[model samples]
Target: MNTPPGLHLKIAEWMPENGEVVSAYDIAENFGITIRQSRAFLTILEKDNAIETRRGKVMPITCHNSHRRSTRTIKVISIDRDIIAQRRHHYNTYRHCPLKSINGLSRAEKWEFIIRNARRRKK
Candidate 1:
C-alpha cells in the first residue's frame, strides 16, 4: 500500500538519525497512531526501500493504574547507509566520543558510551 506523501514526510521527520534505531511504539506515539498501524507503515517503508528493519525481542510491561498487562515486540529501524555515514561524520566532527573502537559494541552500549563520555567531557 502506498503511504500518503504527507504521512510519509511526517514519518521521515520522526525517524531517528540514520544508524540509530527507533521502535514501533515510538513511532505510534509520535504520530498519534495505533501500534498496528505503525507496524504497517513501517512495513510499507521497508517495501518501498526507504528503511531497513530488524525484529527485536518482545518485552512485557504492566500499567500502574490498570490490572492489564501487555507484551510489546520492538522493531528496530535504520535509515540508509549514506545518511548514517553523514550522521556519523557530523558526530565525529562535533560531538566526538572518545571511544576509538566502537566496532563490536551493541547499539545500547554505544549509546551509553557516547553519553558517558560526552557527560565526562562537560565536567
Candidate 2:
C-alpha cells in the first residue's frame, strides 16, 4: 500500500525499542491523524513486518479538553534496519557540532557569528 512519505520515519522515532505497546489512538494523537488512518497505517506496517500487535484492554484518553475511551489493540512497532542506519549516520555526522564550543558567547553573539560565517561560505 502507498503510504505518506516520512510516515515510517515518524513511527520509528516514536516507537519504543523495548517492545512497549502503543495504541492506534496514541499514534493518531501523536501524528495528528484520524484514528481510522492510524489503524490503516498500523495494518500496513504489520504487513511489512515492521510491527506486531496484540489485543489490549480498554483505556481512556484525553486530548484538547475532550475525553474518550477505546478498546483498540496495541501495536508494538520496531525500527527498520534502514531507519536505524539513517539515525546512526545522522548522529555521527552531527554529534560534534562546531558551534558547541562557542564558549563565553552570548546567544545573540553566537547567532551573529554563525550568520557571518554562513554568509562568508556563500561567496
Q: Model 2 over residues 1-123: C-alpha lDDT tens digits?
A: 345875855675566653566777778888788777887766666565434445466566655554455435555444467755666567667567664567889999999988877844455
Give the Cα RMSD of candidate 2.
12.4
Error of 1 at 80 (Å): 5.1
- Report the lDDT tens digits of candidate 1 across residue range 1-123: 344544744575456443345556677787778767776776665564545656455545454753435443433365575764565467557755574889899999999988887844354
lDDT to native, each model:
0.59, 0.64
lDDT of 2: 0.64
TM-score for each candidate, following the candidate numbering: 0.38, 0.43
Error of 2 at 50 (Å): 4.3
Residue 74 lDDT, candidate 1, scale 0-100: 33
